[model samples]
Target chain A: MAVSVLTQKKNMPAGNPVERLLAATADDMARVNSLILSRAESHVDMVPELARYLIDSGGKRLRPMLTVAAAQLFGGGAGNAVNFAAAVEFMHNATLLHDDVVDESDMRRGKPAARMVWGNKASILVGDFLLGQAFMMMVETGDIGSLGVLSAASAVMAEGEVFQLAKTGDLATTEADYAEVIRAKTAVLFEAACEVGAMSGGADAAGRAALARYGLELGNAFQLVDDALDYGGQSGALGKNVGDDLREGKMTLPVILALAAGNEAEKAIIASALGKADASDLEVSQVVAIFNRHDTLNRTLEKADAHARTAVEALGILPESEMKTILADVVMHSVRRAS
Target chain B: MAVSVLTQKKNMPAGNPVERLLAATADDMARVNSLILSRAESHVDMVPELARYLIDSGGKRLRPMLTVAAAQLFGGGAGNAVNFAAAVEFMHNATLLHDDVVDESDMRRGKPAARMVWGNKASILVGDFLLGQAFMMMVETGDIGSLGVLSAASAVMAEGEVFQLAKTGDLATTEADYAEVIRAKTAVLFEAACEVGAMSGGADAAGRAALARYGLELGNAFQLVDDALDYGGQSGALGKNVGDDLREGKMTLPVILALAAGNEAEKAIIASALGKADASDLEVSQVVAIFNRHDTLNRTLEKADAHARTAVEALGILPESEMKTILADVVMHSVRRAS
Candidate 1:
């Protein structure tokens, strides 16, 4: 429900979905933000030098905000929910540092990636330091239930990353296999972040499960939209280059769905596009054209909408709150992103 | 003292220092061996395949053996100690994985290094996985006390690795800094393994403290020997090329001592050799000649011996037992190893 949480809070206009979502989650995030900043700042020597480059570089803080918003939505804030909200951001940033190293990426949010500026070793170690810090922060919460959830999520996230590496450039990847990897790599953390939020929020088992399902669906939708945008999202808004994933030989949901139902010629073009890790813009355009011709974008969007609808439906059991409406809107916010 | 902790009691032979020490520690090691083997077997996926590979290559399992030996010496059992021992090996292997990446070396323990075989990303993540696994195993103990000791030791080890990386190729390195780094990097794990063993065995604080001190001194002596061998040990026997550390531009205690005492001419040679990471044996030999001329080798041995003696001295208060004697002889057994 904390849609564009950081964006909404930092620069709110008189009225908009971004402002409404940010305004809705403002009180909860204020508490978590203070702790998040302090927790991150505690490792100043390890994180500050390059972290400011990334953090101050301006990320959405979407995941952590989801954590705090989820907690507040559940009407429970007496526990360590705020601390955990901050902890999730630490974990996310840690993975980002390591990912930049693995991807050999040079830019993040228009600034130099940690590896490009501080070297790969620093990126790797600082990433590690953040991971350790996240673990330490979670342990301080003294919530054994949340601890188990977070650790398992951490392991699953690593497994997903490994699986993705092994499957790169393999055109025969199944939707099921790719979805499983995506669940592990992306959804697990999001799902667990929400689950932990609910758990710390004093939600019952059913409530927690509902929130977890919602998070999983949201994550799927987010990644699907991301893939669709990769070939055409505005360079200035999305923060990632179009065609980067395809160039890296990755087949996202749109590409997967497109190739599955497309004609032979379309499949051939798709295969060729993913073959080169540094494919030209012309190749990217051809693939995008095929996507449009085959209606893969609409198909993929339907699948994403199904997930988002399911997420909102899962929240039917919860008592109505302004936060729930915000959460409901997040589904479309990501799917309808301009950039 | 439960010298024969795992298998045949008669395997606890007592004669010459080296053979006797080996025999005395062999039973406990048998238990640790199986646990490490089984843990590696459970994860054979291509992602962590390098982790299994590096582990299966088998570098004597010395660190885990130290844990086992310490447990038995402190009257801890074979069964309960196995996981702790496994934890020690996990940590050691984790360090090796990271170290190989840092050194960019192509070989480890007579096999292709993790970085060489699986690339830097795999090596780094697997290293992180092993560290996480170590903590997972520690958590099984359900003893927060054990968690505290292990986490603190783990952090120290990480700090040491960072310090070593920072000091790489620095000719002006001092012995104190060298000791600090090793203490964090290697000695703390060994020391913690022993102290935690005593703690698990229900030993009083005084007893655990004494054992930890003993392990600390022994580890220092052991690494000093390792440092010594890096400069002077045979290639095949050492399971690493001679001057391997020097090839990584490492400044060991012998080099530090020699550089400190040698005239301007010898100091210049040391700097020149470090400039060449692949410096030949003849080049290393010239540096060795300088060390011999300055008598730094003897000084290094004398320094190692002092630590060994201190390790032995710390055990004076322990009750008389065969395990005690074997543990005491670790000083001599450690420093005497040619490689």
Candidate 2:
């Protein structure tokens, strides 16, 4: 009863970091949203229709928010930040469209995935369309330095996704491999989003580097929390089913830790369910029980908290401001979501 | 027998324009090849493995040659031409990968598609990796104007693909739609390749526009020939089955013209075969017989020839050089391939 009460209280946040960040960046974000909508448009009907489905789908748009917020933190009031923010969101949404196809995902943002509604072909092409528009927006900014950051990040993100695909369902996948995957597939975009934002905002060298580090750490923490939530959090909150990563044979931290700790019987049970597309809810529950027995979820959350702390600390170099404080809180709240 | 003799003579060119162009730009092309190979590489083994399989699979390497040749015509000797050339090739290969996935193509360049070898997921990711690398190379050149040209072309190309997909099997698809499709899917890249090459080569405004129109017309000719060859050329030469466009339900000029002219019985036969993945060789031949009755293949090639003439005329503004002669001959030879 005491533990349950503690969990309930922890889940109830006194202040919502995302809401605060959104409020703080609302003015800039409106421009970002408009840009995202316009850039996603195409003369091809399917291009705009499919793109709008994913773009207008209730994504948190956190990556672009980070871009805008980072720009604001450096006193950026120009048009470049808006462009960069829109481009970052396009990159994120493009990846989402492709990721859904790669993962054979059925739902995204609490709705049927674009692939499901439009088929894998549409998903793949629209993803490419969005990616092209993203670069177009970046080019419109006329900032080659920031474009370089985003382009390199795009390559690394694809590599991370490929590497993760190769390692999928391999029980021997190491923590190092997982780290590389998250950094490439998830964190690098966050890093680029912030770095480019800072660049657009006219941040000095040190300021830019600080924001990059902050973004990288936050991305790492964010992905770690996501991995844990896929097994521990509610489906309603996640906009996806629990144990999806497990079913997909994703060698996430919780599963890696559980595999390392569990006995032969437990390992066999987990392996049977891993990568089984039709993995039953009962099987998922059984796996979660094993994860609980090993305390892997909590251990994963601990790792996430460490990353979140580092992310907050990375911003220490920046001059204190309301935006900076909100940014730090966003990192903390990212990890706390796993509770 | 006379028609067959004429076809054989037309097919066997006394001097291959592609070979001539290849020889003309050998040094630049060597750099382009090296850049393509190096840029396609990644720490992720699968990235290079899949990319190289397609890149090295004996594509005529025509687009990059166009880039190189366009640059050479301007009397420019600089590294940016090489970069843009390689980048154009990367963009082309990336599209090939995604196109195979979208089209569910079994063979490319007389070999199994990357999607067939590594699965659709790998093809999509590696294609993305190549696109990212392409942009990175463009950024490295620090030529934002050319980058803008290529990036906008990328968006338009994607739109072209999506439009083609939507109109597949619609039967109501028009000549204008076919024109739009081929321009978007094929010609725009050629336009960008040449335009960017001219820009990189320090061409004057008129020179650049002329080269752009040249590439655009050449691309139209190239794709028109490709459509005809899909029905009328040898598989060995086309590197794909006869009637693949029909099987894919692609409303190319050949098919659209035939459909518009065919009686109801002929239309029924074509409709039965259109979009049928398992469409037999016998069915393909039947469709080809109908195509011959209407002489649609020759008409498509005639259209291609017109575009080829326009392409050559577009280059009339430039000073005569060995490269310009070879470029104009390349367009003529592209049309002749379907004879």
Candidate 3:
């Protein structure tokens, strides 16, 4: 098995790692997608309706795909991976629903957020429904260790959100604080997703730790790039309006770096626009110009690249495999999306 | 043990069944309380702040008490009950936080709702955090069976909330629909709480099933009386304004009964008040007057009494014990609260 995987890695496909991971795990993910939809179903019409709306919405299902890939990396394609993958997706979707409500975001995936369409109350409750369903799926797997990982991740994710909420609109928000926020909110789940998937795949302790480290670093890179993209990428490509993080007063790395380096006038420009829901396009452009002047966007991308490198390096301890190679490339691809 | 319990039951001294249950389970409950507080703590200031506010608020802690009592009833209380009990309370509090946000309720336990003080976003997030913690605690117990019970209960509870949301302000709601909603939203958790408590207490299958049935019926009685009290009980006693259900457009048994029994003119009066955020005291009184004319409040109470009777009867198969007696009385006391 090891020799075959090593042979495949030498002639790896030269395209998007995400697409490759998807193709490799398509059969497993097919089961995962079905389980996700089936579990999201409820006797209550609105639950399935709202859940399906968000589930079918254009999320790359990247998190779940990573779970499958990690599991497959460990020679695991047994049924447990499918359950963990579905649970991970539900956790992600649950966060998205709540985050939209928290950020008061109008758009998600270039469509009106579920909160906007169904109202915040529905969004909040349905988010909860998804979360409850997530735990239920995990419990069904009867994998207490993985359940522990995911549950702890869920709590940390919520803490990250609360911490971010507390720091919103505070210009004194430090880069360290921003890092903690992102690590808690985004990267921790990635770490758990990969770790749990590896566990499901029957990875030994060392292999599990390596995948966890890889996932954590990759998640950090993934989020850093996303934060950067929020400012630098086109709205169409990002599937969310640029300046949303700014408008939500999210103290992402770009804003943190910009605030650190900006002069008094530039700082004033960013402050005026920060957390202002109705901050006009012109005002946002002014903030963006200051960010450009400070080159904070590029600087953020640099940090993401560093994390991506660490993520790939984390994979070095593992034996060569097509899935492992694909995982490494996915990390690089995540960072490169900013460019 | 059975003989000692039987002796105590013959000489049982109790004024209120709730107080009796509390005293009986006091030692175990202290541990459960501590677990609840410690688990609710987070490094993030607001997470604990909001959680403490809700936890410290004057909730009767009835759900957790039930868990403790049920465990004790089955000749168990080694340690698992404490975890299950705390998890039960967290689940209850999580739902309370979310329900307040969804209902736009201003008051809970005679204080400003957590949403009112900390904002809906914090409530939603903290609620999620508590729920995550709940699952984490359950995972620690490593009891997959209990975890399954609790997780499935959580999903059912969410479904109940959504079902209730959809039926809100719909005058066409039937008693059967109302029963389903309450079962999902309220009774299901109670059922699971007792069942899991029994499991942790090392109960055999029959005992577990009996306790579960007792809990379900008791929960039904509890909610039925609560709904009745929403209109008939005083604000101070209820810890919330009377007619809250009416203003929130909750189609409880009382409302469903009143609607089915009211004349055209009375129906118009109810339709005007239903779902009206600013429903005046006079308008509420007019609706209450219609309920009085049809005796819908008492009718609801009568339904509660029936459930309470069944709850008590479910315990008949168990060996005679003080805890069993107290459990039966608590069910009666729960319904008696309406008067």
- Residue A84 of model 2, lDDT score: 86
Q: Give lDDT tens digits, candidate 2, residues A169-279.
A: 999999999999999999999999999888878899999999999999999988988898898652213233988998899999988999999999999999999999899
Q: Looking at model 3 chain B, which ten-residue stretch has the lowest summed lDDT? A: B1-10
Measured by DockQ, the strongest candidate is 2
- Best lDDT goes to which candidate? 2
Q: Model 1 TM-score?
A: 0.85
Could you estimate the TM-score for every candidate?
Answer: 0.85, 0.95, 0.95
lDDT of each: 0.72, 0.87, 0.86
| Shift in Å, residue B306, candidate 2 | 0.5
Writing each residue's lDDT as its tens digit, candidate 3 over A175-257 gives 89989998999999999999999999999999999989988998898898889888864221323377888888888988889
**Greater-lDDT candidate between 2 and 3:** 2
Residue B270's C-alpha lDDT in candidate 2?
91
Proportion of native contacts in model 2? Answer: 0.78
B15-97: candidate 3 lDDT, tens digit per residue: 88888888999999889988988998888999989999999998888888888888888888547989999999999999999
The residue-by-residue lDDT of candidate 1 on B1-339, one tens digit each, is: 011111222343446554565576687777777767665532327644776788878576666666666677767676556778788788788778877777787988877898887788777767766766666666566655655666667656665666676678888789997888778777898788887777776678788888899889888877877887776642222233777777787777878988899899988988888748778888888888887787666566667777777887888888978878777765666776742
